[model samples]
Target: MADNRKRRPINRPKFHHTTFATTKLHEMVEFYEKVAGLEPVHYGDEAAWLTNDDANHRIALLALPGLKLPQDKGHTAGLHHTAFEYESFDQWIDNYLRLKADGIVPFLNLDHGMTMSMYYQDPEGNGVEIQVDTFGNWHASKEWMWYSAEFAKDPIGAHFDPDKIAEARERGLSFEEIHRRCREGEYKPEVIPEVYLPEFW
Candidate 1:
């Protein structure tokens, strides 16, 4: 019998931005402007659209007058986070330093085999990620993530000290070398503990 299975299209669809409903419309807008470097492109009484580039808008904020969304409790279902990518390591580091100077600190920093990421939360407790790929091109990064032995060994990724990365940059290390050290360095791989696991048969 000939095998028959549906395969994904060779040209996959690209991703657009994410939208959030919030009570603190103004505050959220300000937070994105200061922290994410987004600019408001459209504004309405109950909605606003922001973007960092020439695209129509990368983030949409819709006002929810008196409603409050539940936080990420064990059983709650909602967005985990939305990530934005940087074009270069210099841009990523510069953004990190700028945010740090503004008193915004990331809750987590991880070095996935294919990328370096920093995660933060907005005032409304919405998660946001800023990242730069170890490989400059998306196609290359995706290929590495799919087939890299290091990623296969530790699928969850490893914790990286953001300060150490900054120090390395300050010492004039090349981006390629910095990324190499991160992938092979002392950082421990993150693993999910049994405590957080759900019971299954």
Candidate 2:
């Protein structure tokens, strides 16, 4: 008998960049720069292009007037928001302080057993994610399904400690360093301990 399970596709399109409308383009630029470290590599009077150290261009900031912001409950139309990855826990901490200084309170903070994240809404009410992946974060068993759920859910009211974050900084690691280590195959990921396991050893 032949196997009934569906086979994975040979290739899927990789994510490139996404554009979001904003009435506050200039303010948004400053937000992304100070918090996310996304540098604007290209721009026009009304539109700006931004890239992180990883991608050439990962986000586009578009100017829109007379636009309705998303409701307090959820996003109203178009792209909800884009999330960007950080290299280490320390990066998130520094960014967190900067966010507080700007009077932006995070909508959510969570530990999904894979990543630690801080969620915020942009000035225009778009979702913005700042996350650092735990080692061996991916669920090898159900890659696509698990991956989708990880980003889709809101992580509001989650608890995290600042001391752990300080430890990462003490080690002198940055997001750039993490990415570099990953690219060079120097970073070895460790499996996260299961939150729930059978009692019997």
Model 1, residue 132: C-alpha shift (Å): 0.7
Per-candidate count of clashing residue pairs (backbone under 3 Å):
0, 1
Q: After superposition, how far is residue 65 of candidate 2 from its true place, in Å?
A: 5.3
Residue lDDT tens for model 1, 56-142: 999999996877565433234656678888989999999898889989877777788788988777767776889998888889988
Task: Specify the highest-TM-score model's number.
Answer: 1
- Model 1 stretches astray by more than 4 angstroms: 1-13, 73-75, 187-201
Candidate 2 C-alpha lDDT tens digits along 1-201: 989886875787787988888878988888788767779998778989898777777778888667775453251345545687776666666777767777865655545434666667666566687877655344542363356563356322234433344444568876445434433334322332222211221
Error of 1 at 16 (Å): 2.1
Error of 1 at 174 (Å): 1.6
Error in Å for residue 95 of model 1: 1.0
Q: Which portions of model 2 miss their true places by more than 4 Å?
A: 1-9, 65-79, 136-158, 161-201
lDDT, candidates in the order shown: 0.78, 0.61
lDDT at position 91, candidate 1: 94
